[model samples]
Target: MSVLQPEVNITAGLQYQGSQEKALVGVLCTGTSCSFLYINSVLLFTLRSKPVFCETSRYILLYNLLFADTAHMVTNVLLFLLAALKIIIAYIPCCVLVLLSGFTDIISPLTLAVMSVERYVAVCHPLRHSAIFTTRSTGTAIALVWAYNFIYILVQVFMLLYVLTKIYIDLHLYDFCSKEAIFSAPIFTKFQQTYHVTVFFAASVTIMVSYIGVAIVAKSASTDRASARKALQTLLLHLIQLSLILTSTFFTTIIAAYATVGRLTLIRVYNVCFVCLNILPRCLSALIYGIKDQNIRPVFMKYLFCQGRSSVILNKK
Candidate 1:
């Protein structure tokens, strides 16, 4: 990640606080399609109740990660596929795109916080662990995460599109995976930029700090402090993965904001490269979860690769 000079062509778009532009393409990018399917398939095999040993809480965390990653993938596929299909269809409204892309982008940090909460309960209140981590409770927690994230996205999206649409008027077609879609509305676009920066910063930092609080609680607990430490390590690793994967997306959105003002040359290359890079982590999320969770890796091997045939084939007399 070397520093590149800002394109001279970009105009008033530079007023955006940071990299908060057309980051939508990061979700709409095509490179991650196959990986999403593969990881999702593996998750089905490994996320069963039988293999989830109670000794370590990683199993629970891994299960949550599966949903998050699968969702992240599905949403990505939808966004990109729609972008491509729009070539054959008529005008697709920016508001619809705004809502879809906003929810799709928040999956990374939201799942991280879910894992942290699971670890917190498992470690902090061992007596009530089973009661709290029940199948019903787990489902409730998951539903809340998805709902909250969506609501958060929805509110801001309306704000972003509405404000930007009112102020500026940039009627142009911006192409990503699909043919250039017309954005003939600048005020709406600025609204989008403003909404993106606010949510991006707030969600990312809040989720991260939540995990840190979980880590602190885990450190104070008496039993399974070791597991707590392990969980924290995994959380840190996941956070790092998120930052790396999101690098391009964050930059691309910034580019989009500028490109709206018609600064479209050297910056476009940066946009393309970063947008493509988003898939690397998204597709690899399953592997990251497996690596982070000891229980998950063995289960993945047992079912996915069908290893450990020796125990079944030969009983040593």
Candidate 2:
């Protein structure tokens, strides 16, 4: 493949200093495992329950989000392991991983966008929400989201393959395989930039608009005080999660910008930031949204720890 082809010169790049790379690998491993376990526990609990605790539209979105987040975390672990071990990965596995990672990256924000819309409908059209967002419809929506992401990944892969067939681009430009490495080719860089901007823009607009609408509707009704509060909390969580994800993406991109300078100290700082930002949000999302959810928490406690069910705190509708 073109990525590992002989003509593509591998640069001897200097980045992380002693113990820095090791620390990153360790953090990634621990974070990935922790996230996997937590998410798996929630998933299993949901499965084992005679009737799932929260099977609404919002819960469905959250269920899918958990799986997507786990996949994203796993890809990060693989990338970090390759970087730490100094493995010269071949083109096929590298492309597959990068595509998988990128696909999940986009899916996350999109899933959140859908969740925001679900909240909007629940708040703005409570009577019709049930009619519109039935089990079959919600399942179809989630399937559509995955379908859209798969097409996005295929388009990206097609572009890369076409460009590689025509021109010789080096994979060695990046210490780890990422979609950003495509930026090395001027043609692909435009597509990468355009795609990133489009996704971020669309997701941002959907989230902001939907949440604002939900908040407005919730606050308008005196009886919806509890819902208003939950909306606020949910909005904060989504923003926090988005900030962490965007920070990781840009942190990696910015570090690549300074790659030519190859400053060990700079790389070390970014490595720490990258690992923390990437891992913390995954764990926190599970804690804040999954374990802390009023309905889900009781199920989790009962199933995982044999603890008695706690009172549900939020609006179940």
In order, candidate lDDTs are 0.56, 0.69
TM-score of every candidate: 0.61, 0.79
Question: Which 10 consecutive positions of candidate 2 have the poorest summed lDDT?
Answer: 308-317
| Segments in model 2 whose C-alpha atoms lie over 4 Å from true places | 1-50, 169-176, 180-183, 260-263, 302-317
Clashing pairs in 2: none
- Model 2 collision count: 0
User: Model 2: per-residue lDDT, tens digit, 47-89?
Assistant: 3474553467777777777777777877877776676566767
Model 1 error, position 170 (Å): 12
What's model 2's TM-score? Answer: 0.79
Q: Name the runs in model 1 displaced over 4 angstroms.
A: 1-32, 49-64, 75-88, 93-98, 152-225, 245-251, 257-277, 306-317
